[model samples]
Target: MSVMELLASRRTYRRFEQKAVPQDVVEDIIEALRLSSCGANRQAVRLVVVNRPEDVARVQPLVKWAAYLPPEQGTPKADELPTLYVAVMQDTSIPGDLATDTGIALANMTLAAWAKGVGSCIMGAINKPALTRLLGIEEPQKLAFMVAFGYPAHKAGIVPLTEQTGVKYYLDEHRDYCVPKRSREEIARYL
Candidate 1:
């Protein structure tokens, strides 16, 4: 699919089909992230892959929505269990620009996952101190994202909004229960 189509199709898939993504495919996604632009060529980003049941189980202790997310229209039920997880991080050795550099690489990986027809949800609601220990990340290294990947279990459809809706939160609208977005004008700004 074209870049526009891919961007339009990207969704935060939490629920997933119980199928394993190929190891090579997973590697390719990480490779794409690796090739993405890095701030000052700091190349501080580190991607940790989790596919095995044991590995995924370990992450549950680290992830939970920071708070109850609002109900969204036409949003699909994310698979509580994802077969794969990618943890994006940055090396501490890089000085003065960890956050910005890591963010760019994280965005690249997110888009790359979408381009592959794999759905992902980026999580920031993590216990940093615990995660750092859980993932064996050392000083100067930080976990920036916990990305979940899988085939969607629901058929996401266009989600509408009202003029009064200030935040662009999605919801389950279609009867089939897939999560799709509405037109760009409803969410984008030209300026």
Candidate 2:
């Protein structure tokens, strides 16, 4: 698919089909991230791809999902959990705030993953201290965020928003997901 189409269709996927993502595919995604725009060209980000069942399982509990949804609806069902995780880390050795760098790398990886029919959820609500220990990452390397990847199990649709309706993602009565986004006219002002 073209980049525009991919951007329009790519959604934050939390519920995933029970299937393993190939290691090479993960490698390709990381490779794309490696070449992504880095703040100051610091190249401080490091990604640890976890595809092994045991490691994926270990990483799952460290992540918290869907803050807008209730506990029951927010958490992925047992069979719907992602099979792979790309743990994005910041190498403090490079020296600088990594927010922009991390965002660029994640955007690249998520887009690349979606192009391959893989869906992802970039999670910031993580148990960082615990995850660092579990992953055996020490000083100078900090877990920034994680991107969960797998085939989507549920449908996510983008819906137009109104002033009265705040833009928060929610599940419809049928459990289908909807994300409300502001119109371009509301967000962009041409000179």
Residue-wise lDDT of candidate 2 within 1-191, one digit each (tens)?
88899999999988999988877678779888889887778899898888889999998888999999997997898899999998899998897668888888999999888888899999999999998898888888889998899999888888988665588898988787898998899899999
Error of 1 at 39 (Å): 1.9
Q: Give the TM-score comparing model 1 with the true structure, all chains together.
A: 0.79
Candidate 2 lDDT: 0.88
Identify the candidate with maximal TM-score.
2
TM-score of each: 0.79, 0.95
Every model: Cα RMSD to truth: 3.9, 1.2
Q: Score candidate 1 by lDDT.
A: 0.68
lDDT of 1 by residue, 1-191 (tens): 88877766776665678777677669777877778776667677788888897887777667754133433322223444677888888777776577777677766777776676677777887777877787787766777778777776655444554564433444344423333345678669898
Clashes of 2: 0
